[model samples]
Target: MTLEQLKIGQRCKVKKVLAQGMLKRKLLEMGITPGAEILFRKVAPLGDPIQISLRGYELSIRKVDAKNISVEIID
Candidate 1:
Protein backbone atom coordinates (compact mmCIF):
# COMPACT_ATOMS: atom_id res chain seq x y z
CA MET A 1 0.00 0.00 0.00
CA THR A 2 0.93 3.64 -0.28
CA LEU A 3 1.00 6.38 2.34
CA GLU A 4 -2.03 7.84 0.66
CA GLN A 5 -3.94 4.66 1.46
CA LEU A 6 -2.89 4.30 5.09
CA LYS A 7 -5.90 4.59 7.34
CA ILE A 8 -5.97 6.91 10.32
CA GLY A 9 -4.46 5.32 13.44
CA GLN A 10 -2.61 2.74 11.39
CA ARG A 11 1.13 2.26 11.64
CA CYS A 12 3.23 1.49 8.63
CA LYS A 13 6.82 1.16 7.46
CA VAL A 14 8.22 2.91 4.48
CA LYS A 15 8.88 0.47 1.64
CA LYS A 16 10.07 2.93 -0.96
CA VAL A 17 9.44 6.31 -2.46
CA LEU A 18 8.44 6.50 -6.09
CA ALA A 19 9.31 10.13 -6.50
CA GLN A 20 12.13 11.67 -8.51
CA GLY A 21 14.69 14.44 -8.35
CA MET A 22 13.78 17.39 -6.14
CA LEU A 23 10.68 15.71 -4.81
CA LYS A 24 12.65 12.66 -3.76
CA ARG A 25 15.30 14.81 -2.14
CA LYS A 26 12.65 16.82 -0.35
CA LEU A 27 11.02 13.71 1.05
CA LEU A 28 14.37 12.33 2.14
CA GLU A 29 15.22 15.61 3.79
CA MET A 30 11.96 15.33 5.72
CA GLY A 31 13.15 11.95 7.05
CA ILE A 32 11.01 9.70 4.90
CA THR A 33 13.39 6.90 4.19
CA PRO A 34 13.08 3.16 3.84
CA GLY A 35 12.54 1.27 7.08
CA ALA A 36 11.09 4.35 8.73
CA GLU A 37 8.01 3.71 10.83
CA ILE A 38 5.10 6.04 10.34
CA LEU A 39 1.80 6.63 12.04
CA PHE A 40 -1.18 7.98 10.17
CA ARG A 41 -2.58 10.71 12.36
CA LYS A 42 -5.27 12.59 10.49
CA VAL A 43 -6.33 14.33 7.31
CA ALA A 44 -7.99 17.55 6.36
CA PRO A 45 -11.76 17.68 6.26
CA LEU A 46 -11.59 17.50 2.49
CA GLY A 47 -8.63 15.09 2.63
CA ASP A 48 -6.08 17.22 0.86
CA PRO A 49 -3.37 17.55 3.50
CA ILE A 50 -2.68 14.47 5.62
CA GLN A 51 -1.04 14.55 9.01
CA ILE A 52 1.39 11.80 9.95
CA SER A 53 3.73 11.20 12.86
CA LEU A 54 7.20 9.92 12.10
CA ARG A 55 10.73 10.17 13.40
CA GLY A 56 9.56 12.02 16.50
CA TYR A 57 7.56 14.73 14.78
CA GLU A 58 4.37 15.33 12.82
CA LEU A 59 4.38 16.24 9.16
CA SER A 60 1.53 17.29 6.95
CA ILE A 61 1.65 16.15 3.33
CA ARG A 62 -0.52 16.35 0.31
CA LYS A 63 -2.29 13.24 -0.93
CA VAL A 64 -0.62 13.60 -4.32
CA ASP A 65 2.78 13.41 -2.68
CA ALA A 66 1.67 10.71 -0.29
CA LYS A 67 0.91 8.41 -3.22
CA ASN A 68 4.60 8.51 -4.14
CA ILE A 69 5.49 7.03 -0.79
CA SER A 70 5.10 3.27 -0.70
CA VAL A 71 4.39 1.71 2.67
CA GLU A 72 3.17 -1.48 4.28
CA ILE A 73 0.89 -1.78 7.30
CA ILE A 74 2.70 -2.75 10.47
CA ASP A 75 -0.27 -2.78 12.87
Candidate 2:
Protein backbone atom coordinates (compact mmCIF):
# COMPACT_ATOMS: atom_id res chain seq x y z
CA MET A 1 0.00 0.00 0.00
CA THR A 2 0.96 3.60 -0.36
CA LEU A 3 1.89 5.81 2.58
CA GLU A 4 -1.02 8.05 1.79
CA GLN A 5 -3.38 5.13 2.43
CA LEU A 6 -2.14 4.31 5.90
CA LYS A 7 -4.42 5.15 8.80
CA ILE A 8 -3.42 6.96 11.95
CA GLY A 9 -1.43 4.77 14.33
CA GLN A 10 -0.67 2.23 11.60
CA ARG A 11 2.89 1.01 11.25
CA CYS A 12 4.50 -0.04 8.02
CA LYS A 13 7.81 -0.99 6.52
CA VAL A 14 9.03 1.02 3.62
CA LYS A 15 9.07 -0.97 0.40
CA LYS A 16 10.08 1.66 -2.11
CA VAL A 17 9.21 5.04 -3.52
CA LEU A 18 7.68 5.18 -6.99
CA ALA A 19 8.44 8.79 -7.72
CA GLN A 20 10.89 9.51 -10.49
CA GLY A 21 13.42 12.09 -11.61
CA MET A 22 14.06 15.05 -9.34
CA LEU A 23 11.03 14.29 -7.18
CA LYS A 24 12.33 10.83 -6.31
CA ARG A 25 15.81 12.16 -5.64
CA LYS A 26 14.41 14.83 -3.38
CA LEU A 27 12.48 12.31 -1.32
CA LEU A 28 15.53 10.13 -0.92
CA GLU A 29 17.49 13.13 0.27
CA MET A 30 14.89 13.61 2.99
CA GLY A 31 15.75 10.18 4.43
CA ILE A 32 12.80 8.44 2.81
CA THR A 33 14.37 5.34 1.41
CA PRO A 34 13.63 1.63 1.22
CA GLY A 35 13.67 -0.47 4.40
CA ALA A 36 12.66 2.42 6.66
CA GLU A 37 9.98 2.06 9.30
CA ILE A 38 7.12 4.54 9.33
CA LEU A 39 4.18 5.16 11.59
CA PHE A 40 1.27 7.33 10.74
CA ARG A 41 0.81 9.81 13.51
CA LYS A 42 -1.95 12.15 12.44
CA VAL A 43 -3.44 14.00 9.52
CA ALA A 44 -3.83 17.71 9.18
CA PRO A 45 -7.20 19.39 9.71
CA LEU A 46 -7.59 19.61 5.96
CA GLY A 47 -6.00 16.21 5.47
CA ASP A 48 -3.24 17.53 3.29
CA PRO A 49 -0.18 17.21 5.46
CA ILE A 50 0.01 13.82 7.11
CA GLN A 51 2.29 13.56 10.15
CA ILE A 52 4.37 10.45 10.33
CA SER A 53 6.97 9.07 12.70
CA LEU A 54 10.26 8.21 11.06
CA ARG A 55 13.85 7.79 12.14
CA GLY A 56 13.01 8.64 15.75
CA TYR A 57 11.23 11.86 14.85
CA GLU A 58 8.10 13.22 13.25
CA LEU A 59 7.87 14.60 9.75
CA SER A 60 4.76 15.93 8.05
CA ILE A 61 4.33 15.23 4.36
CA ARG A 62 1.74 16.25 1.87
CA LYS A 63 -0.66 13.66 0.43
CA VAL A 64 0.89 13.92 -3.00
CA ASP A 65 4.32 13.21 -1.67
CA ALA A 66 3.09 10.36 0.49
CA LYS A 67 1.51 8.71 -2.54
CA ASN A 68 4.89 8.19 -4.08
CA ILE A 69 5.93 6.03 -1.17
CA SER A 70 4.81 2.43 -0.96
CA VAL A 71 4.94 0.30 2.19
CA GLU A 72 4.22 -3.11 3.57
CA ILE A 73 1.87 -3.38 6.53
CA ILE A 74 3.44 -4.37 9.79
CA ASP A 75 1.83 -6.04 12.76
Candidate 3:
Protein backbone atom coordinates (compact mmCIF):
# COMPACT_ATOMS: atom_id res chain seq x y z
CA MET A 1 0.00 0.00 0.00
CA THR A 2 1.01 3.63 -0.38
CA LEU A 3 1.70 5.95 2.49
CA GLU A 4 -1.20 8.13 1.41
CA GLN A 5 -3.60 5.22 1.89
CA LEU A 6 -2.73 4.50 5.50
CA LYS A 7 -5.32 5.37 8.14
CA ILE A 8 -4.59 7.47 11.17
CA GLY A 9 -3.05 5.43 14.04
CA GLN A 10 -1.75 2.80 11.62
CA ARG A 11 1.86 1.82 11.65
CA CYS A 12 3.84 0.74 8.64
CA LYS A 13 7.28 0.26 7.24
CA VAL A 14 8.45 2.16 4.21
CA LYS A 15 8.96 -0.18 1.30
CA LYS A 16 10.10 2.24 -1.32
CA VAL A 17 10.22 5.87 -2.27
CA LEU A 18 8.86 6.46 -5.75
CA ALA A 19 9.93 10.10 -5.91
CA GLN A 20 12.72 11.15 -8.20
CA GLY A 21 15.58 13.64 -8.11
CA MET A 22 15.46 16.34 -5.47
CA LEU A 23 12.21 15.16 -3.95
CA LYS A 24 13.61 11.70 -3.33
CA ARG A 25 16.82 13.11 -1.98
CA LYS A 26 15.00 15.37 0.40
CA LEU A 27 12.91 12.55 1.75
CA LEU A 28 15.97 10.39 2.28
CA GLU A 29 17.75 13.20 4.07
CA MET A 30 14.78 13.57 6.37
CA GLY A 31 15.14 9.90 7.48
CA ILE A 32 12.48 8.38 5.25
CA THR A 33 14.18 5.36 3.78
CA PRO A 34 13.33 1.79 2.96
CA GLY A 35 12.60 -0.33 6.06
CA ALA A 36 11.92 2.69 8.24
CA GLU A 37 8.84 2.49 10.42
CA ILE A 38 6.22 5.20 10.17
CA LEU A 39 3.17 6.01 12.23
CA PHE A 40 0.23 7.87 10.81
CA ARG A 41 -0.39 10.71 13.16
CA LYS A 42 -2.78 13.31 11.82
CA VAL A 43 -4.20 14.96 8.75
CA ALA A 44 -5.37 18.45 8.13
CA PRO A 45 -9.12 19.06 7.85
CA LEU A 46 -8.75 19.68 4.14
CA GLY A 47 -6.52 16.59 3.85
CA ASP A 48 -3.78 18.37 1.96
CA PRO A 49 -0.98 17.70 4.40
CA ILE A 50 -0.40 14.57 6.47
CA GLN A 51 1.43 14.20 9.76
CA ILE A 52 3.58 11.13 10.50
CA SER A 53 5.93 10.14 13.26
CA LEU A 54 9.19 8.39 12.51
CA ARG A 55 12.68 8.07 13.90
CA GLY A 56 11.57 9.84 17.05
CA TYR A 57 10.41 12.91 15.14
CA GLU A 58 7.19 14.10 13.62
CA LEU A 59 7.09 15.34 10.05
CA SER A 60 4.36 16.73 7.89
CA ILE A 61 4.18 15.81 4.25
CA ARG A 62 1.94 16.95 1.43
CA LYS A 63 -0.60 14.43 0.18
CA VAL A 64 0.94 14.49 -3.25
CA ASP A 65 4.33 13.69 -1.87
CA ALA A 66 3.00 11.04 0.50
CA LYS A 67 1.54 9.23 -2.50
CA ASN A 68 5.02 8.65 -3.81
CA ILE A 69 5.95 6.57 -0.81
CA SER A 70 5.14 2.88 -0.69
CA VAL A 71 4.49 1.23 2.65
CA GLU A 72 3.38 -2.07 4.16
CA ILE A 73 1.06 -2.05 7.14
CA ILE A 74 2.56 -3.44 10.32
CA ASP A 75 -0.57 -4.23 12.25
Candidate 4:
Protein backbone atom coordinates (compact mmCIF):
# COMPACT_ATOMS: atom_id res chain seq x y z
CA MET A 1 0.00 0.00 0.00
CA THR A 2 0.96 3.64 -0.24
CA LEU A 3 2.15 5.65 2.75
CA GLU A 4 -0.93 7.83 2.56
CA GLN A 5 -3.16 4.81 3.10
CA LEU A 6 -1.61 3.80 6.43
CA LYS A 7 -3.85 4.33 9.44
CA ILE A 8 -2.99 6.42 12.45
CA GLY A 9 -0.68 4.67 14.92
CA GLN A 10 0.18 2.10 12.29
CA ARG A 11 3.78 1.00 11.77
CA CYS A 12 5.20 0.21 8.38
CA LYS A 13 8.39 -0.18 6.44
CA VAL A 14 9.08 1.88 3.39
CA LYS A 15 9.06 -0.32 0.31
CA LYS A 16 9.97 2.22 -2.31
CA VAL A 17 9.89 5.90 -3.10
CA LEU A 18 8.42 6.92 -6.43
CA ALA A 19 9.40 10.56 -6.32
CA GLN A 20 11.99 11.97 -8.66
CA GLY A 21 14.28 14.96 -9.00
CA MET A 22 14.58 17.32 -6.05
CA LEU A 23 11.71 15.81 -4.10
CA LYS A 24 13.34 12.41 -4.27
CA ARG A 25 16.65 13.82 -3.20
CA LYS A 26 15.10 15.65 -0.30
CA LEU A 27 13.28 12.56 0.91
CA LEU A 28 16.51 10.61 0.79
CA GLU A 29 18.30 13.33 2.69
CA MET A 30 15.55 13.15 5.27
CA GLY A 31 16.25 9.47 5.83
CA ILE A 32 13.21 8.09 4.06
CA THR A 33 14.57 5.11 2.22
CA PRO A 34 13.53 1.57 1.45
CA GLY A 35 13.34 -0.57 4.61
CA ALA A 36 13.11 2.42 6.93
CA GLU A 37 10.45 2.05 9.60
CA ILE A 38 7.70 4.65 9.82
CA LEU A 39 5.00 5.32 12.38
CA PHE A 40 1.86 7.19 11.52
CA ARG A 41 1.58 9.84 14.18
CA LYS A 42 -1.28 12.09 13.17
CA VAL A 43 -2.82 14.16 10.42
CA ALA A 44 -3.71 17.77 10.25
CA PRO A 45 -7.35 18.61 10.88
CA LEU A 46 -7.68 19.47 7.21
CA GLY A 47 -5.91 16.25 6.25
CA ASP A 48 -3.29 17.88 4.11
CA PRO A 49 -0.11 17.35 6.08
CA ILE A 50 0.62 13.99 7.65
CA GLN A 51 2.83 13.64 10.71
CA ILE A 52 4.99 10.59 11.10
CA SER A 53 7.86 9.33 13.25
CA LEU A 54 10.89 7.87 11.64
CA ARG A 55 14.53 7.43 12.57
CA GLY A 56 13.93 8.82 16.03
CA TYR A 57 12.27 12.05 15.00
CA GLU A 58 9.02 13.43 13.66
CA LEU A 59 8.47 14.76 10.18
CA SER A 60 5.40 16.25 8.61
CA ILE A 61 4.78 15.66 4.93
CA ARG A 62 2.15 16.87 2.56
CA LYS A 63 -0.34 14.31 1.30
CA VAL A 64 0.91 14.91 -2.20
CA ASP A 65 4.41 13.97 -1.12
CA ALA A 66 3.28 11.07 1.02
CA LYS A 67 1.72 9.45 -2.02
CA ASN A 68 5.14 9.13 -3.53
CA ILE A 69 6.13 6.72 -0.80
CA SER A 70 5.11 3.07 -0.89
CA VAL A 71 5.00 1.12 2.36
CA GLU A 72 4.03 -2.26 3.73
CA ILE A 73 2.26 -2.42 7.04
CA ILE A 74 4.13 -4.20 9.76
CA ASP A 75 2.22 -6.60 11.94
Per-residue lDDT tens digits for candidate 1, residues 1-75, read: 899897899999999989999989999899999999999999999968999999999999999999999999996
lDDT of 2: 0.91
Residue 64, candidate 2: Cα error in Å is 1.1
The global Cα lDDT (0 to 1) of model 4 is: 0.95
Model 3 clash pairs are: none
Collision pairs in model 1:
none
lDDT of each: 0.94, 0.91, 0.94, 0.95
Segments of candidate 3 deviating more than 4 angstroms: none
TM-score of 3: 0.96
Regions more than 4 Å wrong, model 4: none
Assess the local accuracy of residue 26 in candidate 1 as a C-alpha lDDT between 0 and 100. 94
Residue-level lDDT of model 4, residues 5-71, one tens digit each, is: 9899999999999999999999989999999999999999997799999999999999899999999
Listing every candidate in turn, what is its Cα RMSD in Å to the true structure after a full C-alpha superposition? 0.7, 0.9, 0.6, 0.6
Per-residue lDDT tens digits for candidate 3, residues 1-75, read 899899999999999999999999999999999999999999989976999999999999998999889999997
